[model samples]
Target: MPGIRKSLLQLVFSGTSMRRWNDKMRPMELMEVDKQAHKMIMAWMLYMLNGSDLDRKDFIDLGDKIVLGGMYDYLYRLVITDIKPPVFYQIKANPAHYQQLTQWVLEQLKPRLQSLGDPFWKGMREYYADGASRDDLASRILDAAHLLASQWEFHLIKDLNPKDEEMDEIEANFIQGIEGFQDLIGVRELMQGNKASLGRFAQLCGQLRFQQRWSQTPRIPETAVLGHMFIVACYGYFFTLMVGGCKARRVNNFFAGLFHDVPELLTRDIISPVKSSVKRIGDLIKEYEFKELDSKIFRTLEQGGYFELSRRLKYFLGVDVGSEFASTICLEGDTREVEWDQLQTIYNNDDCDPKDGFMLKICDDLAAFIEAYTATRNGITNDQLQQALWKIRKKYQQVSLTETMHIGGLLADFD
Candidate 1:
């Protein structure tokens, strides 16, 4: 069985420091992690758009591919560390040099990644060892999402740095690369000329990058809601794997983690104290979130004939289930709440479409704890940050998410 380790979790968080577009002037520093968050979210949208053409088995395979591809790309970026795109592609143009560099990257990753078990390590090694290419539909979707996300970042600084000579070439490359994936579902709609409703939804989701978490607190390398969502999703996926979750459970948990905070994009990040300060303030917030979600997001998608997307988003948000943290399973065309034990023993299979909501909540809390811990470690010793670190550690000190994964011991590593 797989087990979560400090090295694995720390490896995922390391992307927080890997800056992007560092060669250009910009409004704000764009990090590699944020771009990854945007890319995966867009990839999920593309995956859903193409669902009609895929079967259940295909769904499982494609979802795993998108996530693994994202992880591999992140690791590669960490190894390359801000190499200019042109120069990097030139390295790729030389097959021998590229293979040599890939070997080095694999060597760098093995110590940090091998703990996840042989299956994951073998798959990752074979992917690069065999030459990573965009041959499948999932690869096309992920590559298109990556291009579109990078283009979105470029648009942020385009007007400010108008005199940069390479800007036009960069923009043209983005267009050309994205165009190559237009044959895939959802790619054409996101292109420059299209006015798809899904495009608008993507833009709305992208705006979360500007909404910083812990909005009032000062911290080194502040994180945004967008990147935080992605981190939690990653934790959820890994934890599911560790706990022996089925394919559908793994995918559902990942996506549920990814969209858990979608309503925050509309309502903005409300700290827990404010939400619970008044008796029914939390309830009122939920009511408002649903209303805004229906009006601004769901209605538009449904009107545009993307009913399935809207339905899935609603399911992810736990609209009918009352809370996103409630464990759930689909049975006989209806979603029903189930106890975690029942889910593990009975419905832990593809046909049931199980989602480990409680586990997702643990992942969410773990992500938040890590965020606080990282900021504190970076020399930001403010009271808010310190208190956050203390609170989460105290809460999970005796908690264990699985038989082999002890939360208290994991938290102790930061001490």
Candidate 2:
């Protein structure tokens, strides 16, 4: 009964409607509750942003004090219950109720909306009408935050126009490097590749740990996948030091990590749960994905004639871009028809050692888990880390227990 009541409350607040309540409640009470709920949701969102670094227990403590706790439970139920919008729209048929709800939402959001700049306000204004789904909300939020943070980066850049020609050239090379890849990846428009914008992306990537799922730990901030690539590249360098320091191996490791997930540009980050769930439905989805990748994502990159970009990525990683080694390095796991032993024999025959690539995988998982731990510290409960660790441990049994323990300890420290 409590759960049902709570669900009804959430439906009312989330612009959904209940038939029974519409007929029974007084207009004044409905309007008052709706207004309060709107304010409460906004306040909770702000709190989540501000106290994002609080630990799980502390976050729960704060959330309990705020309206977010209720909102969280409510949204979760709505998602699980698979409630239909038509039911809500029926309640919206009540003209007074509809007007009151709209007015309340607008009034509550007004201050925050006005505080944002014109560009941001324009985007927000179009967001609802544009049919922006709930999934796109996170990306849009990150984009908006990046836009806001760019003002500071711009000011910082203005102070750094060096007079030295060589220095200028070096700076130009960095810009060119980023732009070159941007075009190749077809993310040029999305990222803009400007110093301020790149800086914002990097910062947000670190802040949000976008590479990671949500956690009860505090999040780092919103970070672009490009930023994660950079971190992985750096980790690859360190990984080389830990193992025998081979120049070629190090280069390969870095490049592999850099371009490993570039296809995500086309697919967006397909969350693992969704991917695994679709497994039961067989290869239909995979076939569709492959077609989508070839037609939409890969075509865009190919049009940029960025084969050289691919070469550079492979060159730095010391692998043949067209080789099976390259495929394994770029794509996680083998999708081929070969058996495990056969695949191993193929790698052995080709002399394409899996060591460096495997290490890079470890680094990737480490960075991701660390990001999750940080998110959990911030006030998010992210069970994804535990799930991932379990999965990886099972998947990479060949990985030394010592190495696994070391990586696990490193991640656990963040907790």
Candidate 3:
């Protein structure tokens, strides 16, 4: 059984410090992690749109590939941080040079990744060991997502970089690459939307990159709400796998993590202290979030013939159930909330389309803990960071995610 470890968690979060578009002038520092978060969101959207066209067998494993692919790209970027994209592509064209560089990356990753077990490690090796690109549906969708997300970021800074000599060339390349994926079902739908519903939804998610977490506190590498959601989603999936969740349960949990904070995009990230400062204030905030989400997002999609997308979002966000953190399963064509213990004993089957709300909450807390812990370790010590670390540790001291996984014990490794 796989388990979450400090090193692996830290390894994924390392992208927080990896800067993007460093050579160009920008309004805010665009971090690699935020870009990656946005990319995976788009990739998942594309996957949803075109997933049925592929083999049924692909459904079980496609989500894993998308998640792992994003991580693989992130790990590669961390090692080759100084290499420009154009220069890196040129190097990639040379098989010998790319292979050598890949081997070095494997060597670097081995120590941090060994804890994930041989199967996962071997898969990563096989993916990049030869320095070749995958051409399957999942790979194509991921590539398309990467291109579009990068183009989105480019648009943000395009006007600001008017004086940069490479700006025009870069913009042209982005447009060409994005248009190249027009054959994809999701990409084509996004591009051809009469109301631009899909495009608008994607843009809304990208904007989360501007909303920083812990807005009032300073940290070594400040993280955005967008990247934080991706981290939680990845952790939710990994933890689900660790405990032997079925494929549907795993997918449900991952998406639950990914969009858990979508309401925040409308309401903004209100700190916990403020939310709970007044009784029922949190409830009021949640009520407003649901209203805005229905009007601004869900209705737009439904009107644009994206009824399935809107329905899935509602299920993931628990619109009918009242809380995303409530364990639920579809029984006899009706969604029903189940207690954690009852869910484990009864509805933990693929056909039920079960989602582990308790598990997602744990993943969210873990992500937040790591954020606070990392900031303190990076020498940005202060009351807010220190207090956050302490409280999170205390909260999880006795919580066990699985028989082999104790949240507190895993966190203690940081000390």
Candidate 4:
């Protein structure tokens, strides 16, 4: 009986050792697989980051390619190795590989952790989580990752966030305000005309345009137009209060700055030379624009049951009516040729006053020049600054008497 007990104890100890060995070996194998997968995924990410300058047209297809080629391998290796054996065996036995892959990807990406710094590392961790459905996981992961990546490309790469604490705070707060406004009113839905026109007016202040020209110009990134508008609106509100304007006027000034360049949505920034050379071109362009606005674009909105959207835009932007403030805000003709008297008349309009125009103009110029200074700090030439300054100074001459005095004093201080 004693011999039998000793033999049983020895058998149990040997079994435990073998089990530990097998467990350790499995992880070693998994690690090897993961290393290969990691290398492959890293290469793929690098390729995607640099291989193509994808525009709006290429985004979907490129996303598909990344999922199939890179994400699939990384996700599959993780699930097969890291997940509990029972689940892994079940998934491996499933015939629908794509479905399984999708499910696993979703499980990994559901939390959508943003890259506080390294997107690649965060993405890898996301890929390794083995619990969620693939489609949902992949969607969330890609969305968050892409958002951070886009911001990095557009803003950070240009060193827009300067090292200076004050400037960083100013820029950060301004961006936060813009993003907050978007969240407050649901910018995506508004821009698509799924919401009211006033909402769209708000969203318009958030849309970023002219990415290519952004790096070259001394102006704020076209992407930050909405953001800059919000800042201007804030300043306009404060300035109005300082000057003892009515609350209604202050609110109007904010809206004016917010929607000041909505026409650019259609016309883009028609450069000065383009507007100057063609006779009757400005009128023709406006006529074409009015037709387009009334045609497919707005009609599409109406058909889609966004009548409130169209109505609100028409009311706030004064699209159908003659509004001196709106007209002044419009980029109709060559600003180079615009007369001081013409500008004064626009400022003195009944619905909006010169004070609003002056505030808007100052804010606009200040934004432009600050952007120029930022660009110069980022290694852009003084030539770019000079060009921006020249364009701004041209309008300075056309400002109202009050604006002229205020801006003159401001410029003197800067000098």
Candidate 5:
């Protein structure tokens, strides 16, 4: 079950949420970027499968092609929708309001959509025509999202590398999780199903492993997002397991660890100090990111009618535009028991337990230390890496986050 959830969450973050902008403002390749966005949309689909029945009823009613295609189309629309002021957030995309949207997507993804001219895509095109029901178009978009998301390679996107037998076990769980649905899950093709786009997507996800983090830095044995996430996930998993985290708690922590840094795909890895340093300026950046995510990510999920994923992402990332610390802000310092308990009362639906959240933070810090240690071992002798390692050792040597953590040994074992 955990493996299935991990695989699904991995798909969502697999796609970079938006196109990378350069110094001169020329756009980067859409294949990788678009793939990441599409995967995130698919993340919502996976979430639906993992979530409650009521949450899935909307898409289930619309039928399969629409469910798969419409999710893609609907989630994909978020990328195309321009980021305007918060005032525009209230305006939902209705059929009457989106003729231009249809025109734009057709222009961009025309070949891919056209090549795989399924009935769902046809319905989406029909919705743009006069008097056609938006309902059909909406469903088709979800279908498109699922189809596009299907074009993925888990090995590429996920930080995991399972053994053959382990993979077989995971696959069985993945299949058995949704009765009558395993056959539907696969890599889809734009030209047709003859070629293996799913396999290609897996390769793309695999390449993400090599996409270096902090490229500007003089790093040794450079830490990639792939390894970082995997280590953090393991740390969280083991820590949660040791602390007696509940089933839901473990899943939440594992997922949170897996996806906590996904926003770096767009923002590059803006260090926490920079985000929190300049008071109002950091607030402004946070504000901008919230708006952008809504436009570039959440809006698609919302319109495609996947609310659960939206809420979950906001909670884990702490970017909720609606609330102070997004959904998971733990008020600074009382005691772990009080703060964790308080969080439960505050956000009843949050998937990550308060304990899981704390454990994730601890593991996150530990992973940062591991990165520095690994980099230095690889011959990265920069003062930045040196200071990073020193500061982490100094701070964590005497811990206060929770009594359950064996922080000293955790770091030592990694060393």
Candidate 6:
């Protein structure tokens, strides 16, 4: 696990300057964070659109390739930088650096691309040769990349006062852009013109798009909201083989891991140490999450045939959407393996655990470990993060209760 994370951290987002925040009048971030957002959003779209006569294996594979392709498009967009583009801009353009970053991304993604059949490369070669006879799929992918990057501006300025006209305009532009780009992916057709669900989704995007994780720790390069989403999704995919061989189950668990933090989208990412410091306060925070989900997030989307969407998301997240086997998700590790059949039965019954929840927990904790470990590696002398490491290791050693997302080989694999 650590080996995989080390490769990803050092190679995938390896920009020359990744310092989180400073006094520059204009902030510039590499598109790595937005790449994460685009991938997750695409996963979600495919998740919603699955079972429409598509083989589950093919569907998952195609979704991965599409997201990676969109990321490639994101890199190519950096082939040129404007002093003031509508979305991302460069006060100082660095073409060589951008090219280097693009090559790094290509190297990381090459394996995934090669695994897909050869026609994808054929499309690539033809498009490169003709220059004008580009594939429609590529254009839509570019559109997806732009959508994620453009809306990410919300995350950047989330600290601004909500009443600020700039925020209002940003929100307006996002809403309007989605409305206009319905043709790009035919996504609106999937929504069935349910403006109510779409409206609530826009609000949900705003809620999560700006919410930062690990806020208490002093990070050398601060983590953003969407960047962590990508991490969780990537971890989900990594663990897919460890649990089982069911194709749909693999995909299901991957998404379960993806939305595990979706509740934090509503309630901000509170540190677990703070939550555990006081039992009553922790319980209070959980109660607040339920209340907010009910009042703000869920109710708004419940009527749009998306009531099922709400239920499935909450099931994955272990929120108030209600499942009888929610407690089973908390059951210990190997226990889940033995009772796996029963869990699957319960899953179909909707009174049960997500087939992937237990594995999801492990991957989620692994993500926490990497976040803390990487910060320390980057020379951030943060006691909070240091303690985070000790506490995580200590708890993993002490706990036999449910294997609680801590893998035995994790520290063994650490650098």
How much does candidate 5 score in TM-score?
A: 0.50
Off by over 4 Å in 6: 1-5, 9-31, 46-181, 184-196, 242-244, 320-354, 397-406
Ranking of predictions according to lDDT: 1, 3, 6, 5, 4, 2
Predicted structure 3: lDDT: 0.84
Q: Candidate 1, overall lDDT?
A: 0.84
Estimate, for each residue in 230-273, the C-alpha lDDT of model 1 and write its tens digit: 88888888888877888888888888888899899789999988
lDDT of 6 by residue, 180-229 (tens): 55654335532332354644454465345455567766775566565665
TM-score, model 2 to reference: 0.38
* CA-lDDT, candidates in order: 0.84, 0.38, 0.84, 0.40, 0.46, 0.50
> For candidate 5, lDDT tens digit of each residue in 1-415?
1111222222232333333211112222333333433443344344443334433333333323333343344334444545441212223335544555556666665444442234435654655564224344334344344334432333232234343344454345333433333333331222132243333322333344445666667764455564455445545644554444444444455556656655554455677667778868676766676777667556655564546656666665655333222224333321123244444344323232343455577777776765676667767788777787777777777664346444654454445
> What is the Cα root-mean-square deviation between model 4 and the actual structure?
24.4
Model 4: residues with Cα > 4 Å off, grouped in runs: 1-223, 300-309, 321-359, 382-384, 397-405
Cα-lDDT of candidate 2: 0.38
- Model 3 Cα lDDT, one tens digit per residue, 287-402: 99899999999998887788878888888888889888888897655788888766566777777888888889888888888898888888889998888888988999999866
- Comparison by lDDT, 5 against 6, better one: 6
**TM per candidate:** 0.96, 0.38, 0.94, 0.41, 0.50, 0.62
Return the top candidate by TM-score.
1
Better of 4 and 5 by TM-score: 5
